[model samples]
Target: MPTPSRIEHDAFGPVEIPSDRYWGAQTQRALGLFEIGEERFPAALIRAFGLQKYAAARANAQCGVLAPELASAIEKAAIELREGRWDDHFPLTIWQTGSGTQTNMNANEVIANRANQLLGQPLGTKTPVHPNDHVNRSQSSNDSFPTVMHVAAAIEVNGRLRPALDQLRSALAERSQAFADVLKVARTHLMDAVPMTMGQTFGTFAHQVSNALARMDDALPRLLVLPQGGTAAGTGLNAPAGFDGFFCATLSEVTGLPFVPSPHKFEGMAAHDALVELSGALNTIATSLLKIAIDIRFLASGPRCGLGELRIPDDGLTSSIMPGKRNPTIAEVLVQACFQVIGNHQTITIANASGNFELNVAKPVLVYNLLQSLRVLADSASVFARRCVRGIDVDREQLTTNVERSLLAVTALNPILGYDRVAQITATALRDRVTPRAAAIALGFLDGDEYDRLVQHPVNCLINYPTVNRAAGA
Candidate 1:
């Protein structure tokens, strides 16, 4: 038999909804219309919607607008929604109405139904708990959806993404300290440049993550400003006098975060500049992560042929038909994730730019891309920290061989011998395919005793005669 359905009426006539679903008419209409993508809103954003509704209901009640009993019912129902109950009912795609009207009404209908059911009323009964007049009493999808967007993005950055980055930074710091003395040849423009401790290499990456974290921290204050009270067109049409203050205070109390109403509700609703700024910060972080991951991949390139300066943990899966080959899969995965984040940032930027006079028609897509970027970056950081960064080990033998063979070692003779003589010695070393020490001896630039005294000094070409003499002698 065909599935049973129920007739639900809205302003635009009636919609045939599935019998068992919690969503009502507007949601059913949206489901039938917007078949744009399979991607739905992130659970965090949905939960944010619930929290927004719950706070509004309490605020309306406090302002003597909504009945306390109905407000209590809506609050209870919204709490269930925020806790992830009835997630399946929110089936609209992320490509729905730009104001996210469909999803907003989806929440309203679900909350109203559940609230009525709590009061011993039958399903679809709008009595005692109407979806519009009471549930979404003083809010519009225009303000409400962006409010949830700001709230959700702030929480995700502070709660999930930052913590993951901190973990990655700590892992790198540990490796930096652990490899403090492992000398390695540094590369500039893919050529051997000079010598640096592996600790310094890892420390540079740690500092990149630290700077990214700081940028994100700097963007939080803007993200905390929400566009909640400006219903419809930033005019606060039906909302009471102190509704915005009460809503923000209630939201702060419930979420334990400092969520304040935007001073310019028009800016908050019309332009998503804050989200654009946040996405830019995330893009910067993604760039740093990609650079770090690529560097790690290069350092762990090969066991025999490539750089082979570092050894990465094998994740058990091997190269096809090559039983002994272990790829730098974690770093590759992280790089790919960062690439997605970068691309998503661009999409958010364009969406932010597409806003018209009074309202942006790109809210849904903007939110979807932002949350996806955050999720991917957070997960990538966690995986990279555990699988690659924490377990990386320096190849001591390879490091030593590369350092000894580098032409940059000729840097030591620059102070003792004139720059012209050091240049001649370096050219001779490269031309003869011999070590700098051998070239120096063969060209009589320095004797074996002097070459050893200067070239193999422990401080690596600081050129302090007394310190060099003591280190060379010791």
Candidate 2:
């Protein structure tokens, strides 16, 4: 049997909305018009909408445009929405209107209907509270959606991604300290080079993460500047005089972030350059994470064959064809996640570029990709730090063997003996399958005592080497 429904009126006539839904005419119309994708807006964006709507009602009341009682009712309903009480009421996907007008209207309708219900009125009454006249007062989808986008992005980056990155950096720094004494041969272009401590290698990874975190912080101030007051065509049409200031003040008070009104309402509504800037930072972070994960997996390639310089944690995940074989599953997962983040950044870049004239029509897709990148990178960073970096073990035996067998150790003798002579000695050692010490001694280049003093002790080559803590600015 058909579900019980109620008729809701709008500018386009009547829309039959389900009786159980809190949404009204506009949202119901959008439900039928936009059947594009299964990817709905995330909870973060919805909660942001609730917060935005709540702040708008309060701002309107303060501006003497909306009645205090009506503002209180809208505030109560909007608070429920912000707390995720009516998530199902927002059923629009990210593939909807480019301006996100449909989703903004969705928030208005849900808040209005629920506010009426709060005032002892039946659903679809549109009586005590009207969605457009009150809930969305002094706001347009063009400005409101972008404002919510900035709020949601800033919250996720600060609350989730920054903490995750800090955790990962701390784990890497701990490992660097733990492996400070394990000396290994550094590789250049997959070939052996001079010797360095494993601590130095891990310290570099920590530094990269630190830089990524710094980049995120750098992008936040711009994100905090909102464009909410730029109603419709950036003219503040039909909005009160100080609506922008009121909105930002209330929003900042509720969110605990320093949100400020955009000085240029026209630029704020017309362009999304600030969000694009944040996406660029996320792109750099993805590149850093990908490099770190790939390096860890390469160093922990095999227990018997490949580099074998590091041992990955055994998480009970075994290859199907090979029993007793444990893979670097955590690092592999991180690498894949980084790849997805990189791709999402590209999508955001293109979407941001698609904006033209007074409003960016690609707001929904742009924010969707940006939030996805943030969530994925944050989750992967946490998992990698906890499961992989913390439990990684250094193969001291392999590192020692590789260091001793490396022909590039001749680099230490370049000052004592000329480069050409050292190269000749290394060539002879490799060709004869003998040690460089033997080859040098037979070639009359150095005595046993001199060779042992110069080449045998790799630390002799690291003249005035800085500690890992100093190198990493710890």
Candidate 3:
């Protein structure tokens, strides 16, 4: 085995970095250590790391950690990194980088090299503006990392999730109006319940989506309350007296995100309750979306072999071996992502609860799970809207057929025919394979005019049955 060559610069001096390794041995080692999943942190996260560093550089200049010239140099280097210059440095496999220390170091090394370059100095150099000493001065892993996490999630939610949700909401609203006249058999536990307009079904989706969007919006404030000033712990240790407020203000100015200092610094630095709580809100939205996806997919299942209530635009093979079968791939992914978000929530809860004080050791696990959750929710929202919600077309004829065939409609007969007689009529209709009207007539439960009146256009009977009417009354 040979020692790998290191990236050296005149400023920070020589670092014993591996030459043969694609990233570094440490990153490779971390990858081996944390073999979690196929789901990588979204690229948005890496870009956000750049944003934080960029903001920090500016703040560093203002705080006198670096003069304007050095700040400008560091800023230019950070912009390159932000524009995707040093993605290789982030190669520390997720496993060994618990708490994202490796990610922090990756940022440090990349910025150091880049800054050294801007200064017309050798690479790996940390002189004029050290990556950690000056560039990352007054900041700690606990603060900067979580700050990036919040910013990343906020950007995703604002730019991606909200737009996708708005699209879904609009689709549902359109469908509701379109489906207003189509009455169908509603199901509770997959059993025939009663009459509900197709429009009402779509309206339910819109309502749920509204709730989800509200939940997602609520998470913003919590996420905004970051620990940027809390260096290493609750106390702003090496930070200047007014640095905390100034640092937050600087972040706000750079990112356009309202980065407010937390009231409880100790709790903020020590616990990830904020992450878990905000993630839980995201999971709640995911859960709502899960229901939306399931209902849409089930409705769009089939024109023959399945519950063919609606038809979705086909894309590709959702199943491997099943020919002519178009699986609800988008809905499936949305539901699966919901499960993942929930699972990540559990991991975050367990991790946060495990810590004693001053720091949660599961920082990497927490942030990793959080990033996963944000990506899943963002991706799933688009999928659900684009693949399922937008392209849907109701099978109006099938809906009518299902509604007409349902013996549950005999409840309309109950008001005039009475429960006992209607029950007998229903049983007889089922046994004799005749219509409920026929059974009612044979049993002499009601005369022709009365039976005709009861089953006439749905609303007549509903008006007679006050309980059912009140329940379904629009």
The residue-by-residue lDDT of candidate 3 on 1-474, one tens digit each, is 787475643333433555533233334444556676554555777777777777777776777766788778767777776787676567654454335666765676577667776778754445665666766777887777777777777777777777887777777767776666677788999888777777777777777777777787887788788777777877878766666677678767766778787877777767777778778887788788788888888887776888898888787775578778677787888899999998988888887787666776677677778878877777777777776777778887898788767677778767665788778987898899887778878888777777777776574333233221222223
> How well is each residue in 65-143 modelled by candidate 2, as lDDT tens digits?
9999999999999999999999988888888889999999999999999999999999998988999988988889988
Error of 3 at 105 (Å): 2.2
Return the top candidate by lDDT: 2
Residue runs of model 3 more than 4 Å from their true location after superposition: 1-14, 18-41, 318-323, 460-474
Count clashing pairs, candidate 1: 0
What lDDT is obtained when candidate 1 is compared to the true structure? 0.88
List candidate 1 segments past 4 Å from native: 456-474
lDDT of 1 at 55: 98
Cα lDDT over the full model 3: 0.72
Model 1, 1-474: lDDT tens digits are 989887778889877878788789888888888888799998999899889999999999999999999999999999999999988889989888788999999999999989999999876777789999999999999999999999899889989999999999888877877777778887999988867778778877888888888899999899889888899999999989889999999999988889898888999999999999999999999999999999999999888889999999889888799877789999999999999999999899999988889899899999999999999999999999998899999899999888778888778778899788888888988998888888888888789998878767843432222321121122
Q: Top model by TM-score, which number?
A: 2
User: Which ranking of candidates, highest TM-score first?
Assistant: 2, 1, 3
For every model shown, the clashing-pair count is: 0, 0, 11
Task: Please report, as a residue range, the 10-residue window in candidate 2 with the lowest summed lDDT.
Answer: 459-468
The TM-score between candidate 2 and the true structure equals: 0.97
